[model samples]
Target chain A: MTVPVPFLLGAAALTLSTAMQSPARAQSAPAPQIALSCAGCHGVGGAGEGSVPRIAGYDRQAFVDNWSAFRANARPATIMNRIARGYTDAEVAQLATYFASLR
Target chain B: MTRLTRRAFGLSAASAGLAFAAPATLSAQTQARLVIIGGGFGGASAARYARIAFPNVAVTLIEPKTSFVTCPYGNLLLAGERTLPQITHSYDGLKARGVNVVHDWADGIDATAKTVRLRGRATVAYDKLILSPGIAIRWNAIEGYTEAAAEALPHAWIPGAGEQTTLLRRQLEALPDGGVVGFAIPPNPFRCPPGPYERISLVASYLKRHKPRAKILALDAKDAFSKQGLFQDAWNELYPGLIEWVPLNKDGKVTRVDAQAKIFETELGTRHRVDVGNVIPPQSAAKIAIDAGLTNETGWVPVNPRTFEATRARDIHVIGDANVGQVMPKSGYIANSTSKVAVAAAVAALEGRPAPEPTVYFNTCYSHVGPEYGISVVGVFRPSENGFVETPNSGGVSPRGPLAEQREQRRLEALHADAWYGAITRDAFS
Candidate 1:
């Protein structure tokens, strides 16, 4: 989905920065609106409070590799494999950056 | 911003013309007003999303209740696995997020004026209206199944103040050990496609321990249902010979009900006397939608797939179960999932920007069949020229297997279901 967020920021750096330490650093970077639904399972800022693992500070490269493996059915997962196949490469990268910087 | 209609401002129409006359000037200086009706999954999600993603938009949620009891885990309550308090949520979280939460019934909607009339003799105006007013039970849709009849044979479908669900639970508790529990399931285009099957599973799970000799008769209006294979597999594996599911082809459709008599009459004129009856009647878009002339013959509001804005009316985005979101089961997950898209589109419109382009929605519904057992279905849908169609080969149900080898998966999923509830409620209300 082409989510045109009103809080669009000029954080042209889609790549993760070492300075990112908390969710507040990521506030300037608009978490793609497409990623909003993830909070339904991963909790706010991807800091899950239950059996679902937190994805907030996941490694950037690891997040992308995981999505690729899930989409290709190369990884073992409960529901992520099915969900991952639905997103495009761009969306996967977008979500990876968003969550990586979410903390 | 949408042009306001000249009505329901808590003002006389004669005095209302000025409030809406300078819409362009007024909207430019003030934050866009997003007024939502209903406080369930869809409305709550939208209210939270508007505040999170578009803080510039002023969010106002109009719901009659101060607290909401969800229907998703209600079956667990029937099985004595949960209590109403566990599923009920307060609006304080949304209120904390700067959402204006009003506790009053939305009596009528003035579509032309972009105003909602409240039962408390007030009118709430909006720049863009999000109608998530959920489903309304079609009283007497099945013969003799009136509001009074509901007292004895509880539908327990809509979780309004949790009374119906509680009533059904009480009846189940009061039932005799060997008594029969009959279910009159409704047809398609209803809320939660997999709900009745889940309820049957949970009820059977309850009876297995308490009323060992009890029998459950589930009469389905349709031959097949969501996750039918998985649900049937669980029923056979866990509660064998205790539950009988009657399909429509096998004379399963219930045409009449007598709550006081405790009789469920099928379409073939066969009557079955049961100790407890769960008459899930046919449903339609809530009354406010119909009263506002937003519904079609299907008793659902049709909306633009990209924007989720009501097709018949501009600036009105109708989300949740009230809209004709076919191929998307009227599950709470869908309501929560699609709400962001609707809010995004509504905000885009308020800013004179284009609506979101792609039409993607996600849904995951977890059903707890027995102790430490959970099954789920995932769906990913995209819009086609005709309507929304499921993304083939993308979504699937949990693999069916015996609990011996899949015990960990099942147990983990049960825990995950609890986590899903926690995360979703927190995302919406907190």
Candidate 2:
């Protein structure tokens, strides 16, 4: 179609955005591989150290469910209840696996 | 063989030439130029649909960001489930689909001149303008927390606005055993209905593994949250000691936050200092909405629910978090869904056809409590006597009880969420 130049450009810009967004085919670290700073409180084994509960051996389903609950405000664990609400479902899964794998 | 192929190519070329020259032969009698401000879910979708429905239409999308980073899934990044790049998408795909994406900030809309002024001397004229610039921070809403203070105690309200998530994540990592992370939940009408609680879950999930001793303090303005019963059960069953939720009636309202000092003040003036603070301030429509006279006394655009056309302005449609659609939560899913309906109506109006009747839109907001555990609310909505009303018995919050099917449904919904994001982005840009 002989579209107007501006509209055509607009369409192209959006297409470019989509092209830039498609997930990468090359598999890499799915989550941020920053220094394992969590060891201080969590311990190296992913076991619960103190007030924090044991996250390593927990059920992945339970972890995901809990995070989802926090986001939905379905669950209430003061700071955790609030903190859990901040992550997307995907992030919750990534974290669940990350902590789960530490076991 | 060569002669036949050449002849066929020549015939196709001539037909294409005819098509290019015949704008009048298409649907629109008067070729109109549409300038769209912002390339978010609402603006991008409107641009694509407008171009498709009206072949003679000229569309331009002005947005400064090179990439459209979605806020819907950004929470995943905080929980350390997904990286920022996983949720980030560029405008390249939209560009390929024949959208003129202007990589510039929209300074002002010359409604009288029928032109949009850009930051640098650039300008674009339009017949119909669509502004879906999204919500801006009301920094003055909270005391002691200004734009600069946000650096230390990031609200992370605006997607990619600052480094609140990163800062909070980093601080959470560094916190000693028993460190407290305080989150001040804002009043209703914020962007996401269950967002504050979701953040709490992700943070708690992180702390449950790392700093088990650390606690999450959720100070709320509301008496209850979106899915209180389910979250409470999950927390108690999973990380009982790691979390404690304080509601407004129970002295949970936070009045002030000293960002530099890392202190939070309750309504009764009870001070609870913390290591990390996430204060989501009260919000309204972005400044441009107010400047354009599109917002009402409540500082949000009041639009015709069916079309999303601004009630105050002529031929201008406002969608996304900036608009006040009471029936719908100001979530990204709703914004994306409403944009489609608005686009259909806008297209019908241009073609001199009656707008579609009884538009029913769907919205599903999924949140991750830890990882595999997920909960969601799916609502199907249609226009009612007063405004948009949820379809009866079609959708509700995930059940509070225990079952494999419920969690499995949530897991599938997680994958479905990715596909939905992909599809919506495709519809908007591609």
The 0-to-1 C-alpha lDDT of every candidate, in the order given, reads 0.83, 0.67
- Per-residue lDDT tens digits for candidate 1, residues B311-332, read 8998799999999999888988
Best by lDDT: 1
Please tell me how candidate 2 rates in CAPRI terms.
Answer: incorrect
Model 1, A10-90: lDDT tens per residue? 011111221232465337356676777788788887897698989987888999999999988899788888888888778
lDDT of each residue in B1-430, candidate 2, tens digit only: 0111211111122232345432333332234566788888778767766654443456788999888777766667776777767777788876776778899988887666657788888788765677888888777676787888888888877776325666666776778878898989888888888888878888888888888889988889888777777677767766788777788998888888888889988888989888888888888988888888889988899988888888887667788889978878887667666765676566445433456654655566777776667676766666666567876534567666663535665555455455455555565666
Query: Deviation in angstroms for B91 in model 1?
Result: 0.4
**Native-referenced TM-scores of chain A, all candidate models:** 0.72, 0.54
Model 1 residue B172 lDDT score: 97
Question: What is the overall TM-score of model 1 with all chains considered together?
Answer: 0.91
Go through the candidates in order and give the clash count of each.
2, 93
